[model samples]
Target: MTITGVDHTPEVLTVRWQDGAATRFHAIWLRDNAQGAAFRHPGNDQRLFDLTEMPDDIEIADAQIVAEGLEIRFAPDGAVSVFAAAYLREHAYDRAPATPDQPVWGAELGRRLTRHAYDAVRDNPSARKAWLDDVTTDGIALLTGVPAVEGKVCEVAELFGFVRETNYGRLFEVRSEAQPINLAYTPVGLNVHTDNPYRSPVPGLQLLHCLTNAAEGGDSVFVDGFRCAQKLRTEAPDAFALLSRHRAPFRYRNAETDLSNRTAYIETDETGRIAAIRYNNRSAAPLDLPFDVMGDFYAALRRFSRALHDPDGEMRLRLEPGDLVTFDNERVLHGRTGFSGGARHLQGCYADKDSLHSMAAVLSRKSA
Candidate 1:
């Protein structure tokens, strides 16, 4: 994109590109984003000075179209800043905001699950990039042919990022235990739920690798929590409002730890887009809402629970030996069916989403 013309007021600078599209950049924002060595560190691209260090009365004294981009002079300090047209176009906020790329899905996603061989993902860069993209786009992906070894899930976690250690340690077993502290260690069916909502910063991503599944019946289930929240928003607006506006208390207590957190069941970003879903009946604490709002909150919670339980919205699969599933813990609700008669073992670990996104971007750039 090339700047065709330049226009400026005291507070704003508008650049018209050759494509006939115009974009406006605030003087202060432009100053703050200056790419020169004076504004940003050449090594890390971080700001060298604080925003508070900037003069409040800063404004654009003059603007001119340059061969590389646009150049402007600040009024108060006469500081010169040059902005490349490409950079301006890339960071422009003049048009409608783009929607988030994460696509919500239903049961149909089961038919076309994002599946790849573990060897391919580990050995091939293109496969790795696509597998990561699938995880980000659909909030879930599967890798087959992983070695059915104990603690192998940690290796899978390192494929994208480091494992997020919690009270469960770096990794945890999912088989039945004689004296299980968490319900997950028992051979009982669990309702679909997000994991570890009581933690201050809930784990973003999770990986479960099936070591063996000779059990009678233990199938894995997943539901797109984002899809369910959107359904609630459409069919039961009041219920959606109650769940999104009010915070719910969650707790996990045993001899060693007593973690607690309070957050909305459905959280939205500043732009009102669904950001996360934290629903775990097992860890949920007593309702702390006012008496007047208690009934309404319960109704809303039940309605949302039913939405999560809807069979048409769930993707059920019996993860076989060597099958590993990775998913966004905040956007996808996962559960397991009860099994008996034989041994069923799986190892699981957690990792954040930021690293996954970072690797995805780098891989993309390399391929490009």
Candidate 2:
């Protein structure tokens, strides 16, 4: 068959054959030819194929565009291939390239948390539900008499539903060097703050288990961040906007790893509903915002901070050994009042929202 017209451009092309019917082709086809080495050993210098080796008998039998992409059938070989617009773009065979943002919960984090939830040692549905509701509404809950293993915060979370292990490990240890394992000399003072602001899907649940708490000074504190946020929204909407719109950096560095992230204090959903709050004075980086609004933001931030520290808004409790205290890392702000110079030790862990959701699902199903 004779060919009459063909466009020579690299990106878009028009072709006509013996039947005087014209068809268009994109230049990406030539650039991504299987016969080219670019598609084979992309970064390395490996040779892919020689164009001369392609059989001349191979010819296009039919071509059409469908909702998915271009469909093409080869003649002599009777081979068929559907070139989806998205697939072609993915293969670097389209002018418009495609790039998507990374998901909040990546595959690795998702898989790890799912496995941990499924393999939990102990399951506590009612307690898990209470823990979930308390954290969701008020941000904190105190669990007592749950068996504590050497390194199994997952078991505690599993009893509630599924524990979400965040960037923080399954179980974190906090024992004073002076007091050792006994409950003495360990300072109980901790600043109110959310855990791991740097993580996208910050751990939804934070569980602190008191293995030995005979210390004098270590009472735990919980602040309702959502309440504080609502106060800000009502008193100073502009300041709230500044905090929610701007990104603040957070860092957690240790010998094994150096993790850091920039995020906002108040996060909202698509409909502008308050979603999560990340307020950690210790981890907060210097505030950055429009010069004119910086003052107002700080003023509002100070007010919210003050409200969080207020006795009326906070729940204070001393965790005894064998007590498991869990809170919503997203909605509850937690801290410690420095303990007496006595001995004290606590173990902590990070688990994600999925586990909590799983636990909720199981309970709902059983109840239904």
Candidate 3:
């Protein structure tokens, strides 16, 4: 096995392989991947190509050894990719090989749930943030002790830096009365799914607060859609790949408004890591694909949907009057069980991921 060598110096190093091949790597790539937020944030960060594509077709061209690192021209594209000597020495590229069959739910879910729970309340000065960080990995955070009020779920969401508005920025209401916003009857049992699949940029997070839950059988349900996707990848790789490669249409319309969009079942980050899952049977419109693959796609969708709805694969909880459940709308699938006759009023609001992340950062700084 060939061992990669690392050198630490003020200037970039000229690496020469035993095969008599030489190339100069600069500091730009190292600086961009820095753990510090100074290089990770949007406005203040350096721009680079997708990380997953880094190894492919990369070759060093003209090289300039600088005081801090090497300035090398990348081949073909002639783009500059850098590697800082100090940064290279500090970081290791040999990450533990990822286990393809590892389970991503359960304990892993608990950790993420806790982190979100901690960040959710670590900011509010007036509120007492008492929550179980192990609510589930599906991004559910419970905020307790908030004064229960009718039609004030938006207020609770606001405390966590979430703005109150619908996917379309229209003021939407949640009621048990007739004729709901989506033309679907109110208080019906909604499938475990994300909201506003029709919007290009679907709302990232959702907050649902219980004002009154005296009625029975309306307990909230959550499922880690990412976990389900991982399972699909393991058990049915072809189906998983097909879903990830194709786009499915989603639509939502009321008499007054109509919205639609197309997105894949598996969403990936810059590193090709699966980041989110948006599955909603109610909002799914007719898919546009070749007839042969369409049948298989629907079959795969059915199988995944079955897995999601399985009782063994879900986490169930009942929100009390003072309880507020906040979750990542993109990563978690949420639904309500059928409730019988009684006043089970709940109010909800939508917020973007950016706001939640901002809240987490502010809280982290305060704690720090």
Candidate 4:
């Protein structure tokens, strides 16, 4: 990479790459994001200093291309740092996310969702990496041959990142009960939806390992919420706008807590790229929009819901004992068909996507 231009402004440092694309980094941001083991801990890779330790108007006194890296000196303090061209480019906030291009799928995903062996993922490094890759790109993957043991979900969770404990505890049980606290605990079929929309920051990745599925009509269902949003945008732009722009309230209330939040069903970045989908009909509270706008919101919401629950769009798969299913909760809505008197038990847990991506990045760097 070649630096075509270097504008050392007092506020920001603008560096243009070989492709003429420039990323302007605020001097303060650059100083805070300093690389190496000096500012960041080698163990956890977390910053060792707070922003209060940095000068508000810190300027780059000197910046020059040196051996494919940029050597810099901060003004006043004279603290120096070196940022590699590749590192700077990779960490550039202006650059789009490097996530791979993955097409959204519906029922058709049943055939395409790749399956991996639990033993291979646990025993082989390459197998684990490949499994993560498929989950990252496809938004879901299945693992057969999981050992039928309690807390085996943690083994899968630790492979990428730590488990995200919720009010449901670190891990939750999904089985038919006499008096179920959540709909998921009942034998009735659930509408395809994201989990915990009522939480301020909902879980990203979810793992469901079946320990027992000896039941009648208990097949799992999956629908692509992102695809449904895109379909609404293409077919009903007005409805899409209503669902994407208006904030809807979601609540999860019980004896212990009354968690609530208002969020858009469809979230888009500034560039209009679909960032996430939060669809949970069961947890949705009554809309608080004005009387005039409520009609439009409901109309749009119905359209989006219809698109998500379309029979042809659902991917039906009956998870047997020892079958572990993992999915992105933000993009994929999961449900199940009501079962008879037979027992159906599944161990479920949540993990953040940040950890999964961090593991992938580390492994990728090592491989390269």
Candidate 5:
């Protein structure tokens, strides 16, 4: 957008754009956002000065449209700042904020699940970017034709970010065990739930790669926790409010390790937008709410659990050897059916979402 004209007061500056839109910029905001080398670090774009150093009564002395963008002169200090036209439009605060691009889905997603071949993602930047984008938008993705070997899950994680090693080590095994330390090592059917809710900072992403799968009935299942939360928000507002308002405790303990955390079942940001979902029935600790609220809490919890187990909310798939799945650990609940007879084996690992997002952004810039 090109700036056509400028009108200003001591405190605010209004710019008229070529598209016939007018945007008002606060003098303090513009002063703080100066992108010049003297004001910000060129390498990282971090601000050079502290906010406390800025004059409290700063005002705009004058403003004008320049060839590069919009230029403003500040009073007192007489410092000149220029901003690109595109930058101003991109950061305009006068308009309503854009809705998040994330798309929530349920069992219907099974019909057209986001999928990418392992070899293609390894060799093609565009293919990897698309797959990462899929995981970001839908909270899950699948990869076929993986090597079906040990520790391959780590390699997939490296494509985006380093593995987040926990007490389970760099990569954990998944299969029936003689004396299972965790319920996940058993052959019994598991309920749809998030992983490691007991940790302070739960794993942001999870990768499960199948090395072998000859068991009779070990199909994998996924549920969109975001979808479940939204259903409660729309159908049971009181339940949703309670779940988001109160904290639930979760814990995991063994001989050498004991981890515990307390968080809202349905987490929300300052603007009340859903931020994350932490639900793990097996790991939840005893209730500690007030006596009066205990009954209501349990009722709300049951309603939320029902939403999670709704048949229409589940997507089921049977993984074959060489197949791998990646999902947002906080947003997608995973489980499996009981199996017996033949052997079934898989490898899993954890990683953070920030690194995945960083990789996607760099790839996008390179492609552009």
Candidate 6:
């Protein structure tokens, strides 16, 4: 990239990068992010300068486009610094932030989703990369030929990230049982909802590998919470606003521990893209908005809840033995239909979102 021209204002330094794209950098930001021996330690890339001591009106005494980069001297200290054009271009904050490239989907996704063989994930690097892409874009993927052994789910998580161990342990068993500590252990139809809404920064991904599914009715169900939120925003703006604007309390308590958190049912990032969703009716504590908005909030909640239960917004799968289903815990609401007769067992675990992204970036770099 070539710097065609450079312009300086009292508070900003604007650079015209070639091809008509102009980028501006704040004077203070440039000073703080300078890449000189005096300002930055080369070994650790740590800053030696006390940025808090920087003046309110720091000015550029001089600036020139050098062959290597843009060389500049500040007014007060007269400190000379050179910023590589490539570095500046790469680090510019003027560009819009990158959002997750997730494609919202509903029931139709079930019919078209790709199924990879579990053996390939372990034996082939490219198959593991494809698994990464599936989780990134569609928020879900299936492995048809997983080994039907306990703890095999851990291998799938290791390809992307470490397994997240909670009170449920590193890997939890999903099966019907009496005196169930969690409803997931009972043979009942669970409401469509995201997991652990009571916890801040809930688990990012969930993997459920069926060891046995001899049941008559219990089938895996998934609903894209993001897709449902979009529908609610378009159809019921007021309700969507109510859910997004207010923080609803979610709580979970057992014999030994009590956990709670307050969060919006729908969360959005700076660019108004759906970031994370937490909608566990079983874990929802109570409606605690002001009395004036409480009724409206409840009404809005009902509307959103109905949309999630709508068949059109849900995808179903009958995961047989050796089938592993992985899904984004924040974007997808997962549940199961009640089962009767015969046995069904699944081994499940969680992984963080950042770790998955980190592995994907590394893989992309290697492949590129």
Query: In model 2, which range of ten residues has the least summed lDDT?
Result: 106-115
lDDT by residue for model 4 (1-368), tens:
67766878767898989997999898887888887787889888799989898876798888888885887788867777888898888788866765532378878888877789988988887788889988787788999999888898877898889999999899999997787779999888888899999997989999999998889988999988878888898899999888878889999988987899898999887777777899998899998998999988898888898999899889999999999988899888999989986789999999999999888888787878
Q: Encode model 5's per-residue lDDT on 1-368: one tens digit a residue.
A: 78899899999999888999999999999999986998999998899998898899899999888898988999888878899999998898987665552479999998998679999999999999999999998999999999998999999999999999999999999999898988889999999999999998999999999999999999999999999998899898999999999998999999999999999999988767788999999999998999988899999999999999998999999999999999999899999989998999999999999999999999998999
Candidate 1 lDDT over residue span 147-234, tens digit each: 9988899998898889999999999999999999889999999899999999989999999999989998889999999999988988
lDDT of each: 0.92, 0.62, 0.64, 0.87, 0.92, 0.88
> Could you give candidate 3's per-residue lDDT for residues 214-274 as a string of tens digits?
8868877888787888888889988888888888899988776788999998776655567
Q: Cα RMSD for candidate 4?
A: 3.2
lDDT of 6 by residue, 1-368 (tens): 99999988756888898889888898788888888898888887799978777776688877789998999888786778999999899999987788753469989998899999888877777888898889888888999888899998988898888999887889999998778989999999998889888876788999999999888999889999998888898899989888888999999999986889999999888877788788999998978789999889999999999999999988999999999998999999999899989999999999898898988887887888
Candidate 4: segments with Cα more than 4 A from true spot = 2-61, 74-77, 92-102
Better of 1 and 2 by lDDT: 1
Give the lDDT of residue 3 in candidate 6.
Answer: 94
Stretches > 4 Å off in candidate 5: 98-102
Residue 182 shift from truth in candidate 3, angstroms: 2.9
lDDT (0-100) at residue 351 of candidate 2?
72
lDDT of 6 at 244: 87
The residue-level lDDT of candidate 1 at 176 comes to 97
Task: Give a tens-digit lDDT track for model 2, residues 1-368.
Answer: 33444444324545455566555564335333432243357565364656555445555656555554554555554544555444443444223333432122111221222111212224555545545655454445566665556665567665655545543455667766653331222454677788778666677878888777776777877776777777777788887887788777887665665667888788877657677889887666666668987787788778778867767666666777777767778887877777655566778877776666666677766867
> TM-scores for all candidates?
0.96, 0.60, 0.70, 0.86, 0.96, 0.89
Worst 10 residues of 3 by lDDT: 126-135
